[model samples]
Target: MTQHTDVVVVGGGQSGLAAGYHLRRQGLDFVILDAEAAQGGSWQHMWDSLHLFSPAEHSSLPGRLMPAQAGETYPDAGHVVDYLTDYEKRYDLPVQHGTRVDAVRRNGERLLVEADSGTWRARAVISATGTWTRPFFPAVPGRGLFTGRHLHTVNYRSPADFADQHVIVVGGGNSGAQIAADLALDGNVNVTWVAQRPPRFLPNDIDGRALFDVATSRRRALDAGHTDTGGVASLGDIVAVPPVRAARDAGHLHAKPMFAQLSADGVRWDDGSQSDAEAIVWCTGFRPALAHLSPLNLRRARGHILTDGTRALGEPRLHLLGYGDWTGPASATLIGVGRPARDAAHEIAGSL
Candidate 1:
């Protein structure tokens, strides 16, 4: 079956929802196609212990303020999913759940968005597919040979399942720190956090709010053709979240250098020493989910699609949103995504 719309959003996550809201404000007819069976994007797949480093207000979307639970300063992964679900319902966003997009190709003047459900011919296509689906795994010797359990942050659920086991948490970012801290609470679990370098820790007073502010300032300076002198912390910098701070105070927060090889039972350190472990948790990171855009020939060699603001550099009809800092400074975070999404919506509306 084939349908038509002014715009077809390829993702139904926070970014896509934000774009949908803006598109509605423009009085544009659009449909949001979600690959998942229900609402909630990457937030639904996050580990049980994950919580926003920022307060509810600083981590909200454009239209509504995310209200926190009583006595809860930071919302957890479940809370985020609930809020996103509510946002979609509140706006009555035209979202087609369980519609897995297959490919997007040029169909004359409009773009043909082929999904599992049907085909959509859109004047413009807004792709909000985030990075959580593509987990990155560093190449380590004997990685394939190791039989012990190995998983990424995407697959991790809770610390209880890792109890009574020695686990190696890999990556120098927030995920590694948080997961390591969470595992420390379980007395039976022994966790060694490994990274290429020491992870930076943010001052307890500052959170995602300050980070977003700094990133915004830097982006503005760059937009004005000026040098960015502001010092904003990267998203990976360990926020002094209660759990991580408690873990640090308890002497459980420690960093180890990256290991050289993965043995069948455990990993061997670069210093020729071996650490026995039952499992390995890779919190490395993710790549953008742009496989469906292959037909457009816009993907760069570095696994990114170049864009002028939100519009694809070579293909203006294709707008990429919420991929990462490359698309827009601070575009990956919930609060940071609004500007880019709105900008893309206006650009699409104006063009049409």
Candidate 2:
């Protein structure tokens, strides 16, 4: 039997929840299918010490504000989990937990969302499946030759796992900086951070809230057909979160040039200098999780679907939400996903 709804939202993460909120406002009957048995989405897989760059007040989904933590300035992963669980119950959003969507295919006028549990026929489908499942590990030469433990950001849980080991942290993104700082602060590991280029940190005062505001401004300007390069990303790559800042000030968070290749014991620089290590952490980012949508044949050059707003250019019944700016400005963040979610829901409602 195929269940039917106005819209079928894939993934019950922040993006999916945001879309659900707006879809409810539009009075459209919809269902959110989540692979996880519980709430928290990608936050559930975050490192034990991971904290948002912004305060709880600044990071929230649509309709409800995230409650402030008692003693923490920034909310941690556990807090986010609690909030997401409560938010779902508060709104009574129809979420089918433990349902893993296998594929999404066109079925005449509706979309057939085939899942392990069952299938859903929806007039519109919103792909809010954020990139957590698809961790990108760059093809570094001689990576397979390394005899030590190599892990990506997704596999990292805590610094204690690599305690007393000399660890080489790769990539210059926020994950690399934070993980390196986490290990350094733990005082149990010898951390050597490396990036392709020098790491750039935003002002100490700048946080996720400030970044979202700048992104909003840049988005508005771009939408109005004006030239704008005023996004927070233009200012820097790293957000100088407290842990990262502390590690930097303590001389424990400096990044060297990325190694040329991995050696049997560790990594070798382009200058032929070698550094022995027991482990390597790749903090590289992720690609969008769109494998289920493969049946649609809607992908473009960069494994992304061309979209006019959140709606797919080739398939009007499909909307890509919370992937990145191409889907909508800052659509990947907790607070940033709301606008695109609203637009996606609104467009789907109007079309329906």
Candidate 3:
């Protein structure tokens, strides 16, 4: 069956929901397609101890503010899931669960969204599928030959699974720091934290809210035709989340240089130092979840779609949201997705 709507939103996470809110205000009929069986989106897959770097007040969607969780300075994954669930119901957004989008391609005057459940033809398509679904693992030497249990951040759950084992956590970003600290704090697991460069920690007082402000400033500067002054990255890479700070202060979360290679049972560093480990966790980041749009042949180098803001340069009828700065500054974060989403909906409404 072919369903018709003014817009078809891919992914029902924060970004998609934000887009839906603006679309509703714009009075556009739209449907959100979500592969996840339920409401939480990628937050459902995060490790048990994961918490937002910002407070509940600062992390919110377009139309609704995330309710504060009592006794928690920073909301955990579960809290976020509950907030999203409530947001969906409160707004009465049209969402189709468990529908995996297969392809998005042009069909003359409109775009065709082919999914496992059904097909939808829409005047515009907004792809808000975030990066969580696509974890990026660097091509490290001897990775294929490693006999240990190697997994990406997406597969990691809790420290219980890796207890009493030597584990190597690779990557320099927040995930790497968090997981490394998580394991180190367990005391049962021997952890080797590896990063390409020295781990940089932001001031303890700074958090996601501060980072968002920095991003906003940088965005305004760029919009005013000024040189790039840098954003959260200029301050540091890791936010001194509570657990990470504790672990660092306890001298349990020190990072080592990137390894030279991996062995069947261990890793070899550039200085010929060797450390045996039973597992390796790749905390490396993720790429945009954009395979569904492959049929359009819009991808350029580095898996990026050329875009002027969120609108694809190749196809103005399609907009990419919440991927990263390319879409909008801090667009990937909850508090940051609203502006681009609003702009995208505004542009779509005007065009239609």
Candidate 4:
């Protein structure tokens, strides 16, 4: 028999957990379905030594403080996973792990969610699956010719993984610069960073706020349609952290021209420069994974869901958390996702 619920939350990450908690608080029948076997999604796949750039104080979820050791600057991926697991246990949230939803369709007034196990009928659906579901790899000519091992930054963890190997880190984002710096410190790997444009660097603390504010502001501006004037972008969209800048200044992070193509031996740049490396780390970025919900005809641009606050256009019963800006002050962070979840849950409750 198919189970019926008031709401079905797709993706049981931090956002989904928070959504479930809020839904329960509102006394609504909801269930969280996750693709992974466990609660944490991307955190489970992250490298061992990975620590959140945001401090623990900024990483805490709603009603729960993220645990941290004394004098620890930031919490690692393990800490995040532990916290999320604890949060689930604390809230007694209903989560179905290892259950992947293959497709979702609207049947008159209710929605039907079909998975490998069975089907779920719900009055509402929340797509909390984050943007990192899809990795963005540019299609450069001759990319297949590279003989060396090439992987995206999502799969990267520590420099020890590439000990004594010549590594080429592509992109100028924080992830690329940090990975390159870590590898360069090993003193065995020859690290080169390929930057399409020189990064704008900011201090670790900006105006008593974390440097993430700059990026957050830019994201908000972009979403608000305020930064597209004159075909010239603002600094917030292009700047890197001060530590990244210091690394570049210290010669640990060497900037190469934009990536043009991949050859059998190494990568070729737009400036006719080439670097023969043992491995390539592409730190380009990620996009939302919405391939499973083709029946909704959801509004989107550049593959990003377009919604006004918590309400998804044409599908009010469908809500999306962590899609774009307005997730809160720390929207993309674990702490930030909770607010949207709560807000969306409240909105869903009011409708019911």
Candidate 5:
């Protein structure tokens, strides 16, 4: 049987939830399809020690406030999941979890969404499956030759997982630094961190502003092409502030240059140095999973979905969120998804 609706939202994360909320507010009929058994998406996969750099006030969804404990810097991944679950219940969003959309095709004036359960026809579709869907692993020589247990930072949960092992964390990103520090303090593991560039440390406080805020400001400047040549701070500076600084001073944090090659025993760096570790955790970034959408022909050469904030390839019904700078405050954060959702819903409503 083919079920029909006004809008069919794919992926029930923050973006999909926000879309459904706005669709309901506009008195439109819609159905939300998500692959996960529950909401929260990437938060469910985040490390146990992970917390949002953004404050509680900025982490809330469109209509509800994120409940936080007193003196909490930012909510943990579990808290984020709880808040998203609450948002879904509070708004009575029509979400069908565990239903993955296999393929989306335009059927005359509507869209045909084929899922495992059945087929759905809708006037519009919102592809809110954020960029983190695919993990980015570089193709380094002898990567497969390494005898160590290797995994990405996405799969890392806690230092307990790497206990009594020699762990080498690659990448100079926040995740790499934090994980290396955690493992070093575990007393059961030997930790080594390798990066391409020497990290430029930033103070926890910069003229009364929090380091996170300063980093965000700098990111905005870079995005807007207004970054100062010498004043710009790198990822290391952003992560080296406050808590991270203390971690470094306590001998829990150390950094070396990038890895040049891998061997049967361990890794060799660009400076001809070698480290023998039992486990290697790649803290590299993520990429978009668009190979399934090959029929669309909408991506850029760089693998990003080439769409303006409002439309894709002149198709107003196809909206994208969390791609580059389109998602407002929530662009990279879960909270930033709301604006894109609302905008996508309004655009769909107007088209209909």
Candidate 6:
């Protein structure tokens, strides 16, 4: 017999945990299906030395505040993982680990979630399976023939492996700059940063706190029925954190436009110039991990499912959470996802 639940929370990441907290309060019989065998979500896969843009005080979920060493301003990836692991145990959220959902289909008025482990028939389904597993790369000509070693941010570790080598760092986002800085620290590595546009670093004072405030205002404006221009775009760019600042001082923060094409040994510029690269590190970014939802016919162009708030358009019984701001205001951040989680769970409960 197939297991049944009042609600099925997909992904078991920060967003899923948040939703689980609220669902438990609503007395809803819910299960958080996690693809990983263990907790910590995708933070476990981020490159080493990665740090949050905001301080611990500002980066928190709904109930428990994220803890950090007293003087530590930004928490690293391991710190985040520890906190998330603790959060799950603290809330006692019913999470079924190692159960990867293959697809979610409509079963009459309910939703059928078929996973590797079992199938769940749920009154409502919340998809919080974020983008970590889906790293993106550009379609550069001859990219397939590039013989040099290459890696996206998803698999990147320390820069120690690229010592004394000519490496091209792709993407102007924070990851791109940080990796360039890491590889250039000894001044022995030839690190070239590339992106379609130059990296924009927010002022030092404008850390996570300021970003959160702006997002909150945008949320409030939308709640009052106003169009938010999504000024949050800049927030996703590089921040002038210590490492990035050090990189700027070292003259390593500069970026080149995306190369015209990838050569067997390096890249060719549109101007017929060439740079020798022994390896390439891509920080291009990620797409939503929505392959499991493909069978539902809800996916729209640009790797997203259209939604009015957290509810998938025309699918009132299905809610998509934590994919990005499009799914909820500031939904990608630890501090921002709570509101949507709470609201989504409440709505699901009331409908049932």
Q: What would you estimate as the lDDT of candidate 3?
A: 0.94
> Model 4: per-residue lDDT, tens digit, 259-321?
788889997777888778889898888877777677778746767655767667778888878
Off by over 4 Å in 6: 186-188, 223-230, 234-236
Estimated TM-score for each candidate: 0.97, 0.98, 0.99, 0.89, 0.88, 0.96
Compute the lDDT of residue 159 as modeled in candidate 4: 80
lDDT of 3 by residue, 163-271 (tens): 7999999998899999999999988999989999998999999998999899989989989999988877889999999999999999987898899999888998899
What is the model-wide C-alpha lDDT for candidate 2? Answer: 0.93
Candidate 6 local distance difference test against the native: 0.88
Q: Total clashes, candidate 2?
A: 0
Per-model CA lDDT versus the true structure: 0.90, 0.93, 0.94, 0.75, 0.73, 0.88
Sorted by lDDT (best first), the order is 3, 2, 1, 6, 4, 5
Off by over 4 Å in 2: none
Better of 4 and 6 by lDDT: 6
* lDDT at 133, model 2: 95
Candidate 6, 113: how far from true, in Å? Answer: 0.6
Query: Which is the winner by lDDT between candidate 1 and candidate 2?
Result: 2
- List runs of model 1 lying over 4 Å from the truth: 230-236
Misplaced by over 4 Å in model 4 are 207-246, 326-330
lDDT of 1 by residue, 1-352 (tens): 8999999999999999999999999999999999988898889988888999898998999999999866789999889999999999999999999889999999999999999999999999999999988899988899997888999999998888887899999987888899999998767799999989988888888788988888888888888999767546544478889998899889888898888999988999878888889899999999999999999998887689989999999899999999977777789999999999899999988998
Expressed as tens digits, the lDDT of each residue in 35-114 for candidate 5 is 88977877888887777766677677788888874667667788888888888889999899999788777778887888
How well does candidate 4 match the true structure, expressed as C-alpha RMSD?
3.2
lDDT of 4 at 323: 54
Candidate 3 differs from the real structure by a C-alpha RMSD in angstroms, to one decimal, of 0.8
Order of the predicted models by TM-score, top scorer first = 3, 2, 1, 6, 4, 5
Question: Candidate 2's residue-wise lDDT over 115-160, tens digit each?
Answer: 9998999999999998999988899999999999989999999988
